[model samples]
Target: METIEKRKWSVNSVLLVLLFTLFGAFAVFPIVTLIIASFKPAQELMRFGLNLKIDPALFSFKNYAYLFTGESLYLTWYWNSLLISAVFTVLCLLLSSMVGYGLAVYQFRFRNLVFVLVLVMTMIPIEIIILPLYKLSITLNLINSMWGIILPFVVAPLPIFFFRQYASGLPRDFLDAARVDGCTELGTFFRIMMPLMAPAFSSMAILQALFSWNNFLWPLIVLRTNEQLTIPIGLATLLTPYGNNFDMLIAGAVLAILPILAVFLFFQKYFIEGMTAGGVKG
Candidate 1:
């Protein structure tokens, strides 16, 4: 019986490994193709298109050089994206966490109704309300500004819901203890509870950062100036009726993913920890 069980466990482990390997390949194939294509010149990319097989003669750093040293405004676009993403992520986490904490910890009337509203907001797709959002931005005179991109969705409902869930798991004893020790409500949150919620912060930080970094359509609508354009919009400009700069476009896309990779690598451990912690609490 023991030997049979051991054999069964070994087979299951092998199957799990195989499944993960397949999933990883599926997710990574496009990224790998893009990176390889970024090294090829526009003429080569146009003629050959993408392939798994690589040729040493076809690969060059000219596209990278053009991005950095050439007259192209790739660096400006990169800076714009990084700045917007960073600001949006920080503000989102701060505001959303506060709102979440209030909903979870406080016993104010209409709390459940407010949370239901947040849930409903999350269910609604942004595409449905984008026109109203654009009109609001125009009315507020926020168009063509970086704040225009950052403000509308900075305190997003998803993060609020996530934080509320995570905050629910926290011990009420800590709150009581802090109150007895003469800590103000804000002081307890910032000085004590906030430290204990590190996993939630890290998880939300990574997600909000990635969303802000990749946001395209809203920014494109709001920002009319080339100087204010984010990475995605800037890359889109590479393709026009007049011509296409495939090399630079691919290279820019490849580089654009680096910040997201960095954010995930930094917070990946906390991301799993936060999700599990919240899940177990409920």
Candidate 2:
């Protein structure tokens, strides 16, 4: 019996090691390649091929420097992307939270039907509606403006689902207790629920912020002006007329992804909890 138990423990340990080993090779390798690529010069980068090369002498910071220089316009992209994503994320938080609260807390007519619709909307890709949406934005005179990007993002279904799931897990008695103290429905939501909901709220905001920040296609189709472009578009502009200038391109990619990486690293624990909130609930 003891021998059999030992064999089981050994098997589990080996499986665990293999799982991490596989994940690291796929996930860590690409990011490591990107970070290492940022330091290589143009000629050296070409010799290294697609994968990241490991060489002490081949490294240079020129890619990073060139990225920030006035000629690059990276800072303009940075600021514009930051502002647009921030505004869109804040709007999503407010809208998703309100909608989620209504669905999870209120006893309403057609509630399940409305929620099913929202769930269905989540499965639909944004690509299908882009053409008509673009035409509508053009007719509304919002083309090439930040609104071109921000307006459509206001109703993303996942954030609403995330907020609803987390809100559902909270104790309903607290909401009832607030009502007993003469709080209006609006008052209870803003005063009691909003404060308690901050952990999940921040997590969802981070997710939406990253999505909006990394959003490429919508801004690419709608934004035509150089000054109006977001970082993803701006970085994409770095692609040479001939071919990708791999060093500069990767540098811009690094810059584009770093802010959200920082945010995730800081708030990761709460993010995981929010994601798992709906797994086993009544």
Candidate 3:
């Protein structure tokens, strides 16, 4: 019996090790390769992938250094992305959380209809709206403006749906108890309910921030000036007809990805809680 138990334990340990090894090869290895490749000279980049063999002597920080030089636009792209993503995230959270909390807590006429409508809006294809949105932006004389890009994304329906779903998991008795203690409707929400929903906010913030930061297509339609371009668009601008500038392109890609990676890693715990709260059972 003891011998059988020991064999079961050994099997489980081996299985865990195999899972780790597989992910290390597929996920961790690619990131590690990219980090190493960023230091490699342009002469070695094409061959700097995960399985490639090369001398460590061929690696240098010149690629990163050149991209970070005073004349380079890398910092500008980073700054724009950070500012826009932060603003968009907060706005989306506030709007979605308010609407979601209202729907979750209140029973009003047309309440179910409104929730269904919001859910329906989430199903609308983003591509279908591109042309009409561009036309509307033109009519409103918002061409070449950051508002043209920011304003449209501000009405995020999916965030509303996600927040509403999360709100459903919260205890309704908390709101009733708050009211019994003389709390106003808005006060109960602001002080009690919103605080309880932090995990959901963190999850939505991570996702919305990533979307806003990496937003490419809408920016392409609305932003004409290089100065107003977001990170994704800015990175694409590096690919010009004059020459591709492989080293600079790779450098820019590395620079662009780091912040999003950092944000995800930072809020990973909250993301898990939010996903679990929303009933994924993760």
Where model 3 places Cα greater than 4 Å from the true spot, the runs are 1-20, 46-54, 240-242, 273-282
lDDT minimum window of 10 residues, candidate 1? 273-282
Cα lDDT of model 1 by residue, 155-241, tens digit = 788778888888989999999999999999999999998898887898777767777889889998998988888999999989899
Tens digits of per-residue lDDT for model 3 on 54-135? 4677767798888778877777777777888888888878988999878877789999999889868877888999999999
Cα error, candidate 1, residue 74 (Å): 0.7
TM-score per candidate, chains pooled: 0.89, 0.87, 0.85
* Local accuracy by lDDT, each model: 0.86, 0.83, 0.79
- Per residue, candidate 2 scores C-alpha lDDT tens digits across 1-282 of 867766555787899989999998998788888888788776766776556566788777888898778887778888999899889988889988999988999888999999999978977888999999999999988899998789887877877787788788899888999999999999999999989899878777777787788888999998998988998888787786888767678888887778778887999986676556445353
Q: What order do candidates take by lDDT, descending?
A: 1, 2, 3
RMSD of 2: 3.5
Which ranges in model 1 have alpha carbons more than 4 Å from their true place? 1-23, 271-281
Winning candidate number (TM-score): 1
lDDT pick, better of 2 and 3: 2
